[model samples]
Target chain A: MATSTALSTTEAQRRRARRLTGEVLASWLFLLPAGLLLLAFVFYPLFYLLYVSLLHWNLIGRARFVGLANYSSLLQSVYFWQAVWNTVWMTAGTLVITLPLAFFTAQFVHLELNRRLSGLYRSAAFAPYVFPLVASGVVWNLMLQKQGIANWALSLLHLAGPHWLSQGVWPLVSIILVTTWQFFGYYTVIFLSGLQGVPPTLYEAAAIDGASAWTRLTRITLPMISPTLFFATVILVLQGFQTFTQAYVMTSGGPNGATTTLVYYLYQEAFQFFNIGRAGAVSVMLLILLVAITLVQFWLSRRWVNYDQL
Target chain B: MVNSIEPLRHVLSVPPHFLPLHPEVGPYAGAWNSAPFGLFYLNTLFMASAIVLGQLVTSTLAAYALTWLRIPGRQAVFFLILIGLMVPEQLTVVPVFLEMRTLGWINSYQGLIVPFLGSAFGIFLLRQSFLQIPLPLIEAAKVDGASRLQILTRVILPNSKSALITLAILNFIWHYNDFFWPLIITNTNHYRTLAVGLSMFFQSGSGLTPWNQLMAADVFIAVPLFLLFFLGQRYLVQGVMTSGIK
Candidate 1:
């Protein structure tokens, strides 16, 4: 009997081992496509980018080792500094317009407006986002002309509209306005969703205590939806850093490179000038800045981005 | 409104007329015939379909494996995906562009489609959805002598329809309107998608603006998306939430 039991146990263990091996094989087969693609397109390219950043590769002749020369040059380059300035301010500009408007609009519409009206509002609001950036930029390019509708409307209000595409500050502002129009609806929806997640009983309790609307919003709503607020802010900042299309389509990084954001500069350097080494340097810096920004965001979020409730 | 008016207007009138009293289809037809927008439409359709299909397949298989199977180095795969999620395309655009050039994929469909075939966002979205599927159903399938592929197709996928649709719609819209990568990879009118095509058309003139035709083209480009957005707003919004910390 003992011998028979031992034989059965060994057979069962062998079957289990075989099944485990098959499972692992299946898992690997499933993982292979995504794994290979991500590695090839994402991970390997990152290392490749770093290596290229270290060389003076111009897509002509042989690449020579340049070490940190591109980075140092970018530090002193006027165009590079202007590009950085444009990126920071444009992002800040968009955030300034978008955050308050989105938050307030979400609260007002989500709380007070009926569903029918809110749907209409959503359609109008998200239309800009739905419109292709290039196409709209093209349209806005026309609309912002000297005698175009944008200026005409300003004339209606007896206010002067600046030369939107040609002027230095106004070019950036025009980009910001278009971006705000594009993104406000999307962020409002996010804030709306976040607002909805806040428990109604908290509001009821505050109401029972005769809490005013302002007090209720400050004391209850703000703290509860802090996570969503933080998420939106992070996205806004990231989106700012990557603002290329507007500049490309609207300004062509032009009017004396007034609107040349970092990405625009990188594109010109890499493709137009074929300065692959310099572009690679810009890319590496962007990646590092992105990581540093993300880290800083997370570190700062612990201060006020509440996660306790949910 | 002015798109119709511009067709009727004899001059570039300021504060352009809102109503098209003597409207004609000349501008629309002229715009359509002037450029290869038909080909642009086809290229966009082809690229979006290829990318959406490829991303769906890769995201599903990877999500299923990571969720259902006890694979080694699961943490590493997750970490890889997280990095993929965080890194923007521009950060890697230089090297990837070089890679594409080396592969002779510049101005080719391969350049447009291959890089986006595996989306970290899609995989993450699907994984989150898959995690919510009741384990007993999968166990029951296994007990019924179903193969792993059958279980995935018949059992797992069927339950994740909404997530799948959300991803598809989002992917389709995004790639359909994507300009940056397409602009870089495709230089000629032959491979240019609609967004790139329109931008090129706008720049075709040497600062001699074609307002009527441009508006007509812009309207045509925008209307289909407006329809899609109205139809899929719920899915798009849900998809956005998924990308957030939710």
Candidate 2:
């Protein structure tokens, strides 16, 4: 009887081992398509960008192996520095307008307003987000036509309308203003979510301690939602670097290159100049710039982004 | 992972390229001024309708399949869609444009509409929402020999209204703000949408842009969506709270 039992147990163990192997095979089969697509599209393009950067690749000529010449030339170019400056200034300009305005509007809208009115306010604020870039650009163009409603409105108010799309200063403003109209609601939505995470207990305690709305906001609400802010800022920085469509569609790199952001410059080099090698080199720089900016933001976020437990 | 593109307010603050000759008279002075307003409203309405309609059909079917269909390679398909979440739209420009050109659909609504049929983020969001539906209810329907299609339409969808709406709003904002795809595909003014139209206006170089006119036009595009959001604020808040955090 003991010998028979031992033989049965060994047979059961063998069956279990075979089942485990079958499960492993099934899991991998299920995962294969995702892995293959990632390798082909995501990793291939990334590596190809590097390979193209090393060659004197243009549309018309053979791609001769030029080693790191493209990178070196990009580093020395004045346009590279100008793009960097534009990216930083645009990011700062956007943050200044968007962050505070979103926060204030979110604070007010999330307060004890009537339900119907609150809905109107939220939808109205979020309206710019719905029109495609093409539509927004067209609408703004028509409105900003020399004797457009905007100037007419200003004319009524006895103030001269600035040529916002023409000169350097207002072109930058044009890009910034359009961008803010699109994003403020998104940030507001994100901020509202972060605010909900903050318990009412904290607000009640602050109120009991005679804290003003401004004080409670600065001391309590801001700290709690720091993580969300950090995430938003990271996205904003990445976006600021990739600011192409507006420059492409609205300004076309400028009223004298005032809005020629790095990505747009990359697009022109590759498509217009047929300088594929230079474009690859520019993409490489952009990748590096973005990674560096993200790292810095992550490091600074530790100081202010308050993940609490993290 | 669905995200919105930035709008162009900065351009709106600029003046018109060439001011129209002012009729030194009454309300007709302002009536013509509102042409930009009419243009803004028209563009916004068109974009919003297309986006909401596209998202409703695509997300519903994709979500249903991922949730209920007991097909071979189902998990594989879901994961494949999920991989699209991280790929920036810019990367797809060359291939999509090539595809559109081949189809002879360039500068048409079909070119704009067809490619977006597969929305990975929408599928994922709706799938998550479907996952929240209690299993026992579905099982009870199955026991009654209900068709899989009937179960999805009757049981799963009704329970997931809030999630569906949230995904719709998200898709609305995203497709509305899209510029690169529309710009590359469409060539003429007749096909030009708002973002593309604005770009042409800015680059036309006929003259300086009038800031107030731009701002007024900017107001027109922005106001409608803002009003809708206010109406849906609670649901929007609830949508974000559940979708991302949970």
Candidate 3:
């Protein structure tokens, strides 16, 4: 009887081991489809991008391998540096307009209104976000024409509106304006929802302590919403770096290349000019910029992003 | 302000009118009939639907595995997946374009749809949602002798319905709005989506564009997306809030 029992115990142990293997296999099967797709597309292309950046191929036969020559040419090009400068200023301009406007708008909508009114206002504000950038950009192009309503509105204010779609600062400023108009509502919704999550009891406690309105805002509200703020800032900057459709439809990288961001420059190089090697170098530079900025933001986020709420 | 359609002399008057006093569909008809707008709509619908469906199934399964399965190298895999978020899509487009050509998928629906089938954002969001489901609930399901798939469908998915819908709608609308991939992949208008097609229609008249017709085209292109935004606003808001805060 004792020997029979011991044999049964060993059989159970073997069965358990097989079952463990089955579970692990099941888990892998679940992940396999997604893993393959991401590996092939998202992950593989990154390394390929790095590799292609080192090649000197147009849309022709035999991509001749070149080392750092493409990058050197880009570094020396006036047009490339101009694009880099334009992209930087455009990002800074858009963020400056976007974040403050969104925050204030959210505060007004959430704090100064009843529930019904806020809902109506939120939908109205976010409606612009739904439009395709190319389509609205078309409208803006027409509206900024010499006889357009944008100037007519400026006439109503007794201030002349500059030729918005023209070269120099106007084109860059126009792109920023349109981008801000389209996207501020998105950030506003994020901020509004973040604001909603803040417990009212904390506000009441501050009120009881005779805290100034600014004090309540600075001390309680901003700290509580820092995670959302950090998320928004990071997302916005990443998006700003990739501003393309607006520049594409509105200006076509322009009369003097005034509004050419990195992406527009890359597109022009790849498709129009067929400068594949140069485009690859631009892509590599963009990749480095994105990865570096992302890493720095994440590292810096630890300082101020209040996750103690979590 | 052009008050009406295609009376260009009146439409391009010094000051634009607020109301469409002489409301007519002349420009709308012109815009609609001008291009293969209907085909463009159909292409976008099909493409966006395929992407949404593929992403949902793959992301849900992957999120579940990452959350519950005691697999080796899981952390490294997760980190690698998260790297997808850091790299911009534009940076990878060239290589992806080359790969698509090599696969003979250029100008095909597969070219448009395949590269975007797996979304890292969807996986991350769903994983976060699944983690929010109480472990005790999953434990109870397992104790009842439920198989892994059964437990996922019965316990985890039922609880993550909102997150699932959010992922679906977001992916759908985003792909619908997408122009870059389609512009690169499709050399012909046969498989072109609306955004690119619309831009082509606009540029069809390179020097002298019909402003009224262009506005009409813009209106039609925008209305469908506006409808979608309204339908998905609540869940979209919830998804964004959850993704950011936690």
**Candidate number with greatest DockQ:** 1
DockQ per candidate, 2 decimals: 0.67, 0.17, 0.61
Chain A only: TM-score per candidate? 0.97, 0.93, 0.95
RMSD of each: 1.6, 8.1, 2.1
Error at B83, model 1, angstroms: 1.2
- Residue B235 local lDDT, model 2: 66
Candidate 3 all-Cα RMSD: 2.1
Query: Candidate 3: interface RMSD in Å?
Result: 2.4
Question: Over the stretch A1-310, how does candidate 1's per-residue lDDT look in tens digits?
Answer: 9999999999999999999899989999999999899988998999999999988877978999999999999889999999888898999999989999999999998889999998678667666776789987987887788878788899899999888889758998999988887788889888988988999999988989999999998889999999999999998898889889899989899889889999999999999999999999999888877788878999999998889995
Query: Top TM-score: which candidate number?
Result: 1
Instruction: Estimate the overall C-alpha local distance difference test score of candidate 2.
Output: 0.66
Tell me the TM-score of each prediction against the true structure.
Answer: 0.97, 0.69, 0.95
Candidate with more favorable, higher lDDT: 2 or 3: 3
- Indicate the worst ten consecutive residues by lDDT in candidate 2 chain A: A29-38
Candidate-wise lDDT, in order? 0.87, 0.66, 0.85
Which docking category, incorrect, acceptable, medium or high, applies to candidate 2? incorrect
| Stretches > 4 Å off in candidate 3 | B1-6, B244-246
lDDT string, candidate 1, B180-200, tens digits: 899999988899999999888
Worst 10 residues of 3 chain A by lDDT: A122-131
